[model samples]
Target: MTKPNILHESPSQTAGPYVHIGCAPNFVGIQMYGGKDLASNMLDPETSGERITLTGTITDGDGKLVLDGLVEIWQADANGVYPSAADTSGTADPHFTGFGRCPTNLDTGIYQFQTIKPGQTKMRDGRAQAPHITMWIVARGINIGLQTRVYFPDESANATDPLLQSVPEDRRHTLIAHKLDDQTYQFNIVLQGDEETVFLDI
Candidate 1:
């Protein structure tokens, strides 16, 4: 599918990393369903991966220049289905909008998002449960994209998840996230190398 155009913004110097433990905000917890105070699954998170003008810069450990980073992500619907392809009552689910975009942030890293976490599917091996969510990532200098599945750490099902199992034990910690507060989340991403994340080839 052709990529979508995203609203552009100059990289803000204000964005900071969640490096200091306890320095991150106390994120509000979100239930998977649309209930009382929760945001409906209508928020869009999409951006570009190739062009620095499209994606933003990525900051290093010292909050330095990490450029040309492209990121792409896919997620299931609120009902979790490769959400973009979902239809409802022959009309389409108005509440369920499947979206994807690659937008660069002030830090020079491309940001991409699609609505809904994919429903848990068994890995080819057929041995575990799978959790899902909107995946966000920053890559190295626009040549390749990094892949990491954002998962809720509190989910009881994560323990039995098959895809989680596919990840090496030492690296599994990167997949889990703590609820910092409502609307925003706080999680640290580990890039590959001496301090690398398990990035996907595609």
Candidate 2:
């Protein structure tokens, strides 16, 4: 076999050790930068709507907990308004920060987020989407952060969500968070396997 004369593009890279020091310094107890680390907490008492807590662990294809994984979530306020300036649907809750980041516990590989349950938002096609939280994951061996959505299993709007409808019926349950209590939800993410969560491209 003949080798190529010119070099090609390099392959993608994994999260490695940098994702910890760079994205979540506080979690590891090496606070270099000022202020709170990314994904520390989503809101304070001033934020309106139903307060909720989400806890879970990141597992690999072999089902081992990934203690070093980092997660980021973006969602609309309780009133379904994004913090972005482009949102013209209405005014979003001034007290709510719709974005959050958190790293898994080093010992147990568990992660947590405190925020309000997001309200339903409209899709670009004008259909009202189900109340859902957008999530991103970065960890060792993952060249690119995987994307997914967390939908409330009890939400009435879930039936007609454009994205939910796109997923096959058999795999839809992976996207829905199970209710642990009135104010808590459990949603674990599986990187790969027969029961892997439904990851998205965008």
Candidate 3:
């Protein structure tokens, strides 16, 4: 008889304050560990595209922010091409890295990512998807990191985005970012309660 192959699930751990220590050693006064941390910047001065700043706070149900939360975002280049070698659609901007990371400020509980405004990318069905930034968040009390996407309220594509259309109309606003200025945006992440951000399965 063949033995049943049952695998034991490993326990999940909440990302604690030490995530900053392990991921961003230099930011917390720790040095000499390795090369330029996992992600200190999303691009160089020569990167192509309209650079923008994304700022937001991750808060609990009561509106209190998670000061230690860490945020990571991924997006395509200005032309809607990804930088990965596997991207066969076209060549992404050579200067764009397409990824960024930021840890929330200890006092203000705000996290900021400076990167270019992402262009629309393609979905598996060959349909053009809306321009957006996908984000992952982690903090002390979060057993598993939460995943969400940020959409621009001013973008015309948001009206027909397949993903956005899938979400209930009333709750879709939680994922849209508020334009603070020509080059700045605010997209808060709510962990619980009525205003919880829409977390994706992946």
Candidate 4:
């Protein structure tokens, strides 16, 4: 499928606002929490239940790895429940692990995740299901951080999902996933490319 043009915000232009422009600094101490709780509570005798091996590469407009960029991902366990007041205030679900952040090493682009697949999320409109993974991205030159979701291509429900549908149909493919294998999926986000990943104001 052809990618959408975002630079031309005009209706006739047919492109959305550009994303992943410059880059940001590598801040070592900027830690933040996420909305949902998807941590594994079941302790492993060998190590902590949390998976720290979530790995992947951040590619640039030329399909080059942005080695110095940082990526953070947060999601619920396979159950699709987030860490919220409904379960416990100021805390996350014991069974539903809540947060994970990893900085890219020397590769300038590869990242890894030792976590399981995220479950289906409740639709904002209360009538549909959406499956995705939330990612907060920061590069070396960019000042403002980018917030977006990495959606699964196999999730057929996304066709009718509200959040997915809210984006123009031409831009919807940005959220789609590229399967690497049965156990791993690759989603290359673009700050500015043919099809930039969809970013929400919230």
lDDT of 4 at 68: 65
Q: Give the higher-lDDT candidate: 1 or 2.
A: 2
**Which candidate achieves the best TM-score against the true structure?**
3
Q: How does residue 44 of candidate 2 score in lDDT? A: 76
What TM-score number comes out for model 2? 0.91
Instruction: Put down candidate 4 lDDT per residue, 71-189, tens digits, no spaces.
Output: 67777655566665553213434554455555555444565556656666665556755767788877665556678877777787888877788888898887776777666677777
Listed per candidate, the RMSD to the true structure in angstroms reads 13.4, 4.6, 2.9, 10.1
lDDT string for model 2 (26-74, tens) is: 7677876675796577787799899999889989999899988989999
- List candidate 3 stretches off by more than 4 Å: 1-11, 33-35
Candidate 3 collision pairs: none
Model 1: per-residue Cα lDDT over 68-139, one tens digit each: 333344554433344333322133334444434343342534333324343554444655456554444443
For model 2, the stretches where C-alpha displacement exceeds 4 angstroms are 1-12
Please report how far candidate 3 places residue 124 from its true position, in Å: 0.6
How many steric overlaps does candidate 1 have?
A: 37
| TM per prediction | 0.52, 0.91, 0.92, 0.66
